[model samples]
Target: MRAVIQRARDAKVTVQGEVVGEIRDGFVILLGVTHDDTIEDAEYLANKIVHLRVFEDENEKMNLSLKDVGGDILSISQFTLYGDTRKGRRPNFMQAARPEQANTLYEQFNNLIKNEGINIATGEFGAMMDVTLTNVGPVTLILDSKEK
Candidate 1:
């Protein structure tokens, strides 16, 4: 499992011109699941994201976690994150998990966040989505379950 976590002032996902999910002062998490991903991977990434200290403190220091700032999360499934472009002009997604497995892990990840007592919004899994966000400080971080 992997996630691109971006701090945003607000974020929303739209599908077929209908808003599917939205959030304010939170994170826009683009998540990807690999063939090797399991529930443990989902849980680890979710916990890391929620506790990441990317938010600023009262003294203007980047010292506050999302939980400390009372923020929400907007999770979006993005299998393309596994696209391997090293070989040729075209990217390959062989490392990405099958839709069935990916969707299950994605749902579990969202549930993990929600179980943390924070509001969590999500884009439709496997749907074409248009995501919009006002990135706060343009703060972005990438987390991969394989790393730790």
Candidate 2:
């Protein structure tokens, strides 16, 4: 499992011109699941994201976690994160999990985040989505279960 976490002042996801999910003063998470990902991976990534100290503190230093600032999360499924372009002009997604498995893990990841006692919003899994966000401090971080 992997996630690209961006601190945002606000974020929303739209599908077919209908807003599916939205949040304010939170994280815009682009989540990816791989063939090897399991519930454990989902849990780990969720925990790390919520506890990550990317928000600023009293002295303008980045020291406040999402939990500390009472923030929400907007999670979006993005299997393309696994795309490999090392071979040629085209990218391969062989490392990404099948839709069935990916969807299950994606749901699990979102549920885990919700269970963390924070508000959570999500984009439709496997759907074409348009995501909008006002990135805060332009703070972005990548989390991968394999790296931990």
Candidate 3:
């Protein structure tokens, strides 16, 4: 499992010109699943992301967690994060999990976050989505379960 977390002042996802999910004062999460990912991987990431202290305090120090600031999450399933482009003109998706497995883990990941009492808005899984966001602080971080 991998997550690309972006701090966003506001964000939205649209499919076929219809807004499916939206949030304000939150993180836009692009989540990916690999073949070997398990519930434990999803659990680790959900715990980390909710507790990540990247928000600023009164002294302008980054010391506030998303839970501390009452933030939401816009979660999107992104299989392309695992695209391997090492030796070919075309990116290879062999590292990405199959759709069924990916979707199962993806949903479980979202549920784990939700269990923490944070609001979650999600893009339709496997859909062609257009995402828009105002990336607050332009702060972006990538996390991989395999690396931990």
Candidate 4:
């Protein structure tokens, strides 16, 4: 599993000209799943993102977790994160999981984060989505279960 986490002042997802999910003062997560990903991978990434201390504290130090600042999340399924372009111009998506499996892990990851008492809004899985966000501090982080 891999996740690109962006600190957002506000974020929203739209499908077919209608809003699907949105959040304020939280994270905009582009989550990806691989063929080998399991519940463990989902759990690891979710925990890391939620506890990540990128938000600034009163002293202007980046030391506050999402929980500390009472933030929400806009989670989106993004299999394209596994796009591999080492060879040709077209990227290969062979590493990405099948939709059935990927969606399961994706849902599991979201449920885990929500279980932590943080509010979560999600884009429709496998749908063509338009996402917009005000990236606060321009703070972005990438988390990969394999990196651990």
Candidate 2 residues lying further than 4 Å off, grouped into runs, are none
- Residue pairs in clash, model 2: none
Candidate 1 per-residue lDDT over residues 1-148, each given as its tens digit: 9999999999999999999999999999999999999999998998999899999998999999999999999999999999999998999999999999999999999999999988999999999999999998989899999999
Task: List, residue by residue over 80-112, the lDDT tens digit for candidate 4.
Answer: 999999998999999999999999999999999
Worst 10 residues of 1 by lDDT: 49-58
Q: Write the per-residue lDDT of candidate 3 for residues 99-135, one digit (tens) a residue.
A: 9999999999999999999999999999999999999
The total of clashing pairs for model 2 equals 0
Q: Which ten residues in a row have the lowest lDDT in candidate 4?
A: 42-51
Task: Write model 2 residue lDDT over 1-148, tens digit each, in one string.
Answer: 9899999999999999999999999999999999999999999998899899989999999999999999999999999999999999999999999999999999999999999998999999989999999998899888899999
Q: Note the residue pairs that clash in candidate 1.
A: none
Off by over 4 Å in 1: none
Cα RMSD (angstroms) for every candidate in the order listed: 0.6, 0.7, 0.5, 0.5
**Residue 120 lDDT in model 2?**
96
Compute each candidate's TM-score over C-alphas: 0.98, 0.98, 0.99, 0.99
Model 2 Cα displacement at 137 (Å)?
A: 1.0
